[model samples]
Target: MNHDSYPDSYIRGILNTVKTIAMVGASEKENRPSYFAFKYLLERGYTMIPVNPLRAGEQILGRHIYARLSDVPVPIDMVDIFRSSRHALPIVQEALTLNPRPQVIWMQLSIRNDEAAALAEAGGMKVVMNRCPKIEYGRLSSEIAWMGVNTRTISARKAAASGGIQRLSLNRASVPGGATEAAAAAERMERERGSAG
Candidate 1:
């Protein structure tokens, strides 16, 4: 699997325009990454349909959980996959069977299936492998307030006053907790600033 994979401008355009997502391998466990990611996207106003065979017919984050992508009733703009690479092909195949077909297929961090990604791409779907939507949302959106700096909040004025280091390394791995939230918030903030400015 290529760890250097990235989505093109066309794929990014699709992700930006999509409002609905079907999350495959979404879990009911509160502590799981998929659970938090699903919740985050939902909180951000995106419609999220959770797909998990183990939790089919159950409710997660106020949305009905389906056993498979084809079971989702509404149209899906994207499919965020949390399953392993070995299991991604079938899911891609399933997503392809949708009426309108999904605009994007995203494989989570550490998950990459080239064959599946190629299949999706060949079928006119954007493919992103070994990437996390949450991370991309934060990075591309600029929700992080002080990415490299140690400070939690810094205004533009303050940045000017401090002679702006131009960068700060939070060494997130060193932070005890809230790393993901911090990153997401910073990314969101940055995106807002970019659009506003």
Candidate 2:
């Protein structure tokens, strides 16, 4: 697991498998990166739980905010840390305490701690560092390319237009199959959970 680079399949696998994500350090500010990311992932259909100590007991995008990961009532398939690298260790430490620990520990862009990654990995969780899941989803799904951004990925198949919005799946395919793939991914995740449990 090289933190330097990740395979497209690995990222696609994660983006496809994860259903609920707990975004640590989520902010209420609309202009903040975390806020933007939270909104994006939510729109993309991932159940988002915001974790902000100061904003606890409040709602961000209609979802209640918790003071800490431990305070989250639901199982978090992935924990997306929007905090700095220095705070990553303690955050990972806390995430490790969950009854069914999160399957993934993701550190946001520009935030990476080898020690934290090691700790999470040692706990049997997959770790992604210095990457934004929002951006990864866009890139892997070819959504960024719709915005005229160079995703460096070329596909032979043209995406189907839905209400003038081009939505592609993680495997670089179009809609109808994306939904099926999502179902399959969920089944796979459940099977993995069954074996692990």
Candidate 3:
């Protein structure tokens, strides 16, 4: 089956509900996409557990590295696979064995396996193939649009207001305040992205 696209609501719902994610194929190298993407999620208020069998017992971004998904002590809401397409099948297989299996299995950009995706879906886990969570989050949250990138979401809501402060949050809303506050949110995102890199 072709998985060239997914329902926005499905992806959004997953992002809204998931809190803890187990990132497989995590890398220690700061320049690696996995490294920064993991940090991006961390800064977005999600707990990211790095998983790399080769780096087991080591720490990545202050999180303990697990050798496998099953090795993670806590339940995982999602499994973010940074590995290639060929490994998706095995990875999903392992994810299914967890006591409380993850609700989602996400293969990174350039990664896709119909069989793996189908199996996970059959097991009641949502599957996202050939996509990057970092990109998805930024897109869904309209963070990229703020950078003058055409997000194609024209029906935009204003940013939310709280405690007399305006900031971009996960919820749908327009930019709350004036230039200063919008700049603040943008700067924060860039800083976190830079540091993660």
Q: Find the candidate with the highest TM-score and give its number.
A: 2
Clashes per prediction? 15, 0, 7
Model 2: residue 139 alpha-carbon error in angstroms: 0.5
Structural similarity to truth (TM-score) of each candidate: 0.71, 0.83, 0.82
Alpha-carbon lDDT of model 3: 0.79
Q: How would you order the candidates by lDDT, starting with the best?
A: 2, 3, 1
In TM-score terms, candidate 1 sits at: 0.71
Task: Give me the displacement of residue 122 in model 2, in angstroms.
Answer: 0.8
Model 3 TM-score, all chains together: 0.82
Tens-digit per-residue lDDT, 1-197, candidate 1: 23243333333465567889999999989999999899877765689999999999998978999999988889999999988778989999999999989988988776767789889988998777666776555443334433643322223322212112333222121212233576556555543443343
Report the candidate with higher TM-score, 1 versus 2: 2
- Which portions of model 3 show Cα errors greater than 4 Å? 161-167, 173-197
lDDT of 3 by residue, 12-120 (tens): 7789899999999999899999998999888878999999999999998899999999889999999999987778899999998988989999988767777899999
Clash pairs, candidate 2, are none
Off by over 4 Å in 1: 1-3, 7-11, 145-197
> What is the alpha-carbon lDDT for the whole of candidate 1?
0.70
